[model samples]
Target: MARKASLSGFPEWLPAERVVEQHVLDTLRRTFELHGFANIETRAVETRAQLLRKGEIDKEVYGLSRLSAEDDKNDPNALALHFDLTVPFARYVVENAGHLAFPFRRYQMQKVWRGERPQDGRFREFTQADIDVVGDGTLPFSYDVELALTIADALSALPIGDFCLRVNNRKLAEGFYRGLGLEDPDAVLRAIDKLEKIGDEAVAKILVEEVGATADQAAAALALAKIRTLDTSFVEEVRALGVEHELLDTGLDELSQVIAAASKRAPGKVMADLSIARGLDYYTGTVYETVLVGHESLGSICSGGRYESLASKGKKNYPGVGLSIGVTRLVSRILAEELVTAARSVPSVVYVTLAHDDSWHEAQDVASALRERGIACEVASSAEKFGKQIKYADRRGIPFVWFTHDDGTHEVKDIRSGEQVSADPASWAPPASDLHNTVA
Candidate 1:
């Protein structure tokens, strides 16, 4: 017999850890809904054409092959798994254009698959919590600021520590690059995006060698990317760079408004970072990236941007602004750092022990009574000694152990504090805090 092989990049959480993940998701769902974003779901699979419409993810999409039909295996327009939720959401908006209300605010939480190589904190299969606001023709710039504040609020609710929601405008970067006499701003943005991974020297070399940029152009781009400010001072910093273009001026104004709005709403949660170039070409306005305070190496745990045309049906275009929380990555870091923990391994708050085989009937009665009172409990199956039952309850992290006495009285013992007291299952109940597994 052959042993099973554990595949990499596919995350499988243990029971206790899964509780934490669920808690985070629940918190995000509640926050998004409270902000008036309705729940929406999209299909997991998409046509290869739809998946690859973004241009960059052609090789990063997983194509399907049907064993039943071998002749059409080479079909170019076959099905593929969506690498991200944004692309699928765009298609869905167009498909259901007539039914959906304009300025649609939706929150989608689902697993998205990517064929890219998995690394630390990066996965081939992961979950994302996304909230997007799409409008008919022109989306309000306030939507951009609103989404950033919403992400900050959602992250603060979770157990993840302080984070930085770095905000940058693509228009700002492109306009500045053009003002510096760079012909290919997008190509330069791509190289500059690699600035952190490969050092400033390597990125500058790429700009001059590959993008046909002069030494001065490469130097100016590096200088622009190095700017980081906590407020609207980034506008002045860019102005001091000596680049002048009407587009650049417009970008500065847009970025200043976003930063000022975010600072007023979220205070220190949002920062102006010129280096953040979200690689997607569709992000025509503000782009975002969030980093856990001390865990910067884990990369952005949440990110997204404002797109002018998230979807199009003939002449009608749906522009939107949104943000996505990388749920799987955040949970992985939480487990690894021991940042939070479930109150109990099982949802069972009380373990009703059997004094003997004959006590099964009474134990069952007590269990039923406790459950009727909204207390989570279970009756021990075996006919075990009282000591053994305590150990059994202790092993599984069940906080309380219930024992029925021969006198027809009942006593509940708290395994955590070792405090035992007389109680009636019909009247007595566990504390609301300890009733269920808690992520603490």
Candidate 2:
């Protein structure tokens, strides 16, 4: 017989764990809508050309084809699974530009696929919750500030412990690199983006060799990455670096404004950290990376940036800023670390016990009455003893079991506290806390 085996990259959760995940997703959705972002879902697959618009993620895209296809490459319209929501959303914006209102704000939660190798918190298939604000031409920088606060609102509502959102501007990093006399600052930004992963020394080597930076220049670039501040003080820190450029000055002021604004509202939640050079090449302005309090090694649980130039089609270019929560990665980390759990595995709030097989219909009737009142419940499959019936509820962490007495009246058993009380199927209800399974 063929043995059952689990795939390494694709993750499946038990019913209880799924409860926790769903709660997190629901929290994110509610928070996003409360902030005025409308819901939008794009297709899961995009043309290879549309996905390749970003230019850097082509290799990581999963191409779609059929086994019977003779020449997939020559199709000119080959489909590929979207590696992230941004690209598909961009394509959607361009395609729907005629109907969509200007300065559209939307939230999308969906699965995305990537062909990259997976380990720890990373996966080949994952879910992402993205909120974006796109404009017809130039978008307000205030939207950037708003997105930061909105993201904070969403994350703070979850069980993920205290987190620090390290904010930066691509202009800041690139301008600093340019001010340091690096001919290819974009390339340097790409290299130093590896600073957190490969360390300063290795990043410096890439700068000095591939990016054509001298030893001192590389050191200065590394020095900039070290500047981290909880408030507007990051302004002086960059000034202290002594690297000056028109773009550098502009970036510094812009970043300082965002940090100051965020601080005034959500104190201690947002900060300036120069090391947060998001790996994506599309980011043109403010970028963010979030690290949980003690789980720093787990990497950013959430991250995003501003892309001013996207899906440019014949005089129309979509510009936007956005954030995405790595849903699967965040849930996986919380589960693996035991950060939170569901109260129970089953959704049933109460289980109806059967006195005998002849009473099955009555038991089901009770269950149906509870359902009509918005209470979830299930009827016992067999007419077992009351003790055995209560044991069934106990094993599943179900809080209550219903019993019908000889008088045709009903009694509810609280399995947890050994408490029993008379109840009516029409009027009786479980406590508010037992209405549904919860994550804590």
Candidate 3:
């Protein structure tokens, strides 16, 4: 079970729960590395200007300052905790552009701070796993499809059930809005993005009153947003709407290619979700939002898009495609829903029993032998009775209890069963499945 956080948004898990979280991190790292993403980490703090330069996220940024310098407001370049990894990565790439290879593949897993209200899966502090491929000048759109496929492959390896990676193109959306005579396409996209939260009727009202969309234009925008398909049928559906623009044609073609590649590479895991308007402004082309099939209320478990202008030095631009998984949110849902659990809380597979105070050294020898054989174990803390030591192993969920006889032989007992056998510390080992903690 998960414990309530002493601080509302900063979650602290019990030892058992931590096993699941650690497994998730390790799995994601392995999956990303297999796809050739080099792991890197940036400082937790970036200059306030550097963070805000990427987007208007001032309200969510937490300003950093020294205890004694709290009142010193004269510094123009104040430090702040980064709200996301993408911005810092952009900065890092530009600073290290000279040393890095073109189309650099990187994976970053780190904690990010955001001053948002706490809710079921939302938090002020959370871990984000981001993978991106950045190019020196212009990046091909093929990476967009690759990112979606990679994320689907990674998530499929986890215990999380079914999920869908919703793909859309910013150019397609903005182009379609322009065809509808909606001059402020971004405002229209923002309003449409809330269609799931606020009903279609509410979104239409916002379009008319706030975004200056005519009733007909609002209806058309909503109609386009409602168009979702698993195949290239979305292209025909958008064409049926009778809206046309050069950019819209380009977006439709790009999205169709993505859907086509996904069909051959990762079917069912990818879909053309027209309503997926990522809230981030930097997404210049393809955008993605993923939701667990049964847990849609948890919102997007993974999201990101292509950014053509986020990272630049002088005339050089590092265009890239990426995706970020909200590690904390996904783990929170897994625990709250009791989706899975660890085989054992601690990593110890064997516990060495102590017969007496003098036997402690002998038990240490046994533990050393087990460690050298690539087995995880521990020695009894005190020279308790045999029954008390066995009980301690059982309580700790250690599978085996080792006993050293008065002479020279050693015997190990399976705590879960009444099975005892003579064994040698140098050769005995548990089954392969019991060698390490696993998700159950």
Clashing pairs in 3: none
Residues 40-104, candidate 3, lDDT per residue (tens digit)?
A: 99999998879887557788889898788764333548998999999999999999999999889
The residue pairs in collision within model 2 are none
Q: Model 2 misses residue 186 by how many Å? A: 0.8
Q: How should the candidates be ordered by lDDT, best one leading? A: 3, 1, 2
The 10-residue segment with the lowest total lDDT in model 2: 1-10
Residue 435's lDDT in candidate 3:
94
The number of clashing residue pairs in model 2 is 0
What local distance difference test score does each model get? 0.88, 0.87, 0.92
Best by lDDT: 3
Residue-level lDDT tens digits of model 2 in 1-440: 11111886678888888888899999999999999999999988888877775578677888888878764754548988899998888888888989989799999999999888888778898999999999998898989899999999899999998998889998888888888888787788888789888998899899888888999999998888899888999888888989888889888888888898889988899989998888787889999999898988888988998898965688878889999999998988888887898999999989899998899998888988899999999889998888888888889878999998767999998888889999999999888888988887
- Model 1 — TM-score against the truth? 0.94
Worst 10 residues of 3 by lDDT: 67-76
Please give the lDDT score for candidate 2.
0.87
